[model samples]
Target: MSAQKVLKLSDLKQDAAVRVVIDDIPIAVVLDSNGEVHAIGDTCTHGDISLSDGFVEGETLECWAHGSAFSLRTGRPLNLPAYEPVPVYEVTIDGDDILIDPHVTKEVN
Candidate 1:
C-alpha cells in the first residue's frame, strides 16, 4: 500500500474541506463537524462541481452545484441528482501529519 502524506492536521480547520491532488487524483479532505477526518473524491458524481467548495454538515458534504449531499464515510450520495457513489479513501493520522492512500479505497455498497 502506497500512502502519501497529504497535509498536516493543523492545516485543516474543524468542519472544513480542502481539495488535494495525489498521483493525479483529486481528493477532498474533510474535517467533519465531529472533529474527525475523512477523505473522498472531490468531484460530485452528478455534476462537475468540487465537493470541497460545498458545505459540510456533520458527516455529509453537500455539492454546491446541485445540492447533492454525500456521506463522508462511504462517499454515497444521500440526496437526489446523484445515484452513484464517489470514491472514498483511507486516511491515516500519524502524529500531526495526515496520510492518504489514493490507491486504497474504502468499499461502499
Candidate 2:
C-alpha cells in the first residue's frame, strides 16, 4: 500500500478541518477543540458535501453543507441525514508532523 503525504501538524489550526488526499482517498483532517487530530473520509454520508469543509466541535465534526455530525475518532454518524459511518484513519504524531495511515485497521504506531 502507498501512503500519501497529507499535511503538517503545524499547518492545522485547532477546531479546523483540512482536505487531503491519501492513497487516492479523499480524507478530512480535523483538529478537535481539545487540540486532538482526527482523520476521516471526506465524503459526507448524508450528502455529497465534503467533510473537510465542516466544523469541528469538540470530538465531533459537523458537515458544513448539512447539519449532520460525525465522531472524529470512530467516524460514527452522530446526527440525522447520515446513518452510515464513514471510514476513519489511524493517526500518529511524529514530532510536529501528523501522519495518517488510511489502510490500517489497527491503532496507529
- On lDDT, the candidate that comes out on top is 1
lDDT of 1 by residue, 1-109 (tens): 6899999999998888999999889999999878899999999999888999999999999999999999999999999999999999999999999999999999866
Worst 10 residues of 1 by lDDT: 100-109
Q: Evaluate residue 62 in candidate 1 and report its C-alpha lDDT on the 0 to 100 scale.
A: 94
Tens-digit lDDT string for candidate 2 (1-109): 6444568889999999999887677889988878888888899999988998888889988898878999888888998989988888878877877887778743422
Task: Give per-residue lDDT, candidate 2, residue 19.
Answer: 91
For each predicted model, how many residue pairs clash, with residues at least 3 apart or on different chains?
Answer: 0, 0
Candidate 1 is scored at a TM of 0.96
Task: Estimate the overall C-alpha local distance difference test score of candidate 1.
Answer: 0.93
Model 2, poorest ten-residue lDDT window?
A: 100-109
